[model samples]
Target: MSIQITTLDSGLRVASEFMPNIETVALGVWFDVGTRNELPKQNGIAHLLEHMLFKGTSRRTALQISEEIENVGGHTNAYTSRDLTAYYARVMHQDTELAIDLLADLIQNSTFDATELEREKQVIIQEINLSRDTPDDIIFDYMQMAAYGNQPLGMSILGKPEVIAKISGADLKKYAGIHYCAPKTVIAVAGRVDHAQLLDWVKKYFGQLSPVSDAPIPPSVYKPENILINKDSEQAHLSLALPACGGKDPDYYAYSIYATLLGGGSSSRLFQEVREKRGLAYTVSAFLSNVDDTGLLGIYVGTAPGEVAKLAEVLREQLVDSSRNIKKAELDRAKQQLKAGMLMALEQPFSRAENTAQHLLTFGRVLSVAELIEKIDNVTPADIHRIVGKMISAKPALAGIGPKKSMKVWEKFELT
Candidate 1:
């Protein structure tokens, strides 16, 4: 497989990986604008705009857009995150042109009709309600809010219900005009794609967009704070987070290994200690999310309400133990697991395409699979110890959803 990247005169970036053996193409556009880019009052505008883009464009109705793709046996979807909004389609290699044109039209020239805006407001409100109904979803939002307080990074991507209801078509268009510039967008394609043809299509579809004045980049703020939400539920949801490395941080690889050893799988410390040995919780895991300026090492577990205290105790013990001393064997295992997962994910065309685009956007270049494995393998036991020490020193922010009594119980067993 070979990857080619080009920047059009209009500033849109096109990156493609040719997979001649495959018959499908996964193509997408990524915008570096999401909830974090919104003004205080326009909190949910980014996500709302994402939804409206698919509703209709200057050339096609929502139903027409769906039907066109389905007729070609293609699939299309979109998502909004803390810092980006993405729209993607997977189709037969022969239909790449149609997919690109449809995506470009939806993102760049959406009408955002008044009626459509009102209709989408209800849809988003329902989405918010649905999120609240799911404990797993709500818990993460709460944990993020607790970690960053009221900063832009802390705000929910779904935005507040009241604010979402008031988002106007004008708001959507204005925000889109400002942040959805060619310079801040990328077109990524993989699987049975020709780089030259993809670049030609990108230029034809996206070159018309006029560049806008660059907006100031927002600083990602990470505050050490704890928040607990009292709810009537059978299982208590607990999340603990500490500020860590970003995508560009030098310790990025080390931190990934650290997270894997902490709670990545069933053999991980948190899982084995908190669940296997003590039977304190049924589900436990750890993950790392690296943004532009900052990152987070987050641990989450769902356990019986009565076992919240024991769960917290065991988690703290494991954390402190790891921070003080991580065995060389354990460190090697974590590195192997991290590298193995990276290699496995690269086999999928969609994953490869997305990985290439994200790496290019964030790091200015993509690291080859072999280079990534080498980096992971080079991490020493001392590297793991140093990362863990930094994490331990950075007081973690905790978020819990369950009975108020559990909060009181868990609070008594803070990380020492």
Candidate 2:
């Protein structure tokens, strides 16, 4: 439960939490660049670079990277998101140094070989086609596109097949060189480890890398007016989004409670009203996505083609009603659920490490578990109602994939 933070002379910020009873350590390097940092022509380069980094580095082949970690019984992987790309490894406490070196080499010295780039391009294109074939996956991307419009935040992390095909080794190298600097990266480790020893290892490995000038900020804010996409599928995939609060917003915790009450679980209002009582759909839920500058409150549902209209109508009614007359008992349950979820997540070391690094990256400091718990507990029914009032006043962007008839029926549920 004790955490330590340090800043290396090289500009890499290192944070660690000591868990004396644990036998494994989770370490990660988070780069503060993703789709939002890409220019129009380089939409998917950050994600592509994630794939390429694993392909090979100047010091080792891709298989060699895999073998080295597996030989130690360690696991390694990476992911790209709208705002960051992360490379992480979990290993026995004794293997922490080896893990650190391997991650450092992959990030700082990746070769981005031309042959490998061509092969990976085809791999990603196949991935894009695969996503298109899956209705549930395809609809969320469309929802993001509709919510953010033409902004970088709206662009797909996988990029278009045509665009991904054109991404060459040169593009990968240029983007990596510009965005992957010490100032834009955070190295985080948690579990059984010595904080001083971890700092020394980071200094030895990453200290020599220089910082980049003019680090890019994330894309400008742009909330869409309204948008819809038509696709052929068995059931209709529907998503509605309105811009909400980010991490720093005063209403951020209140919005989380609001979202939970709206559609968090089986007992949630969306499920109880839309599915359990009315039999409108098989699946329905809501989520709060809080980014650096802005956030989104989204509602998603999958239903029979003929029931899409009914589902949307019920969802709107629930939204409007919740804002108008949220019961005190329901509000109390939502707060307890959110607090319990947050407390449970803190029990895992990996979650703790990630929570530490992401808050540092976004807010420049981490809020303690006590602070977060208190914030959630303090959100009264009145607070939620006020936030809901603001949410209802804003226009929501919608996306759907299903029969042509369902696509046209959304006009009836349009936000005014």
**Residue 390's C-alpha lDDT in candidate 1?**
80
What is the per-residue lDDT of model 1 for residues 125-196, given as tens digits with 9 covering 90 to 100?
Answer: 999999988877788888788788778788889999999988888878878888888888778888999888
TM-score of each: 0.97, 0.97
Which stretches of model 2 miss by more than 4 angstroms? 225-227
Off by over 4 Å in 1: none
For each candidate in the order shown, give its overall lDDT on alpha carbons. 0.84, 0.85
Q: Give me candidate 1's TM-score against the actual structure.
A: 0.97
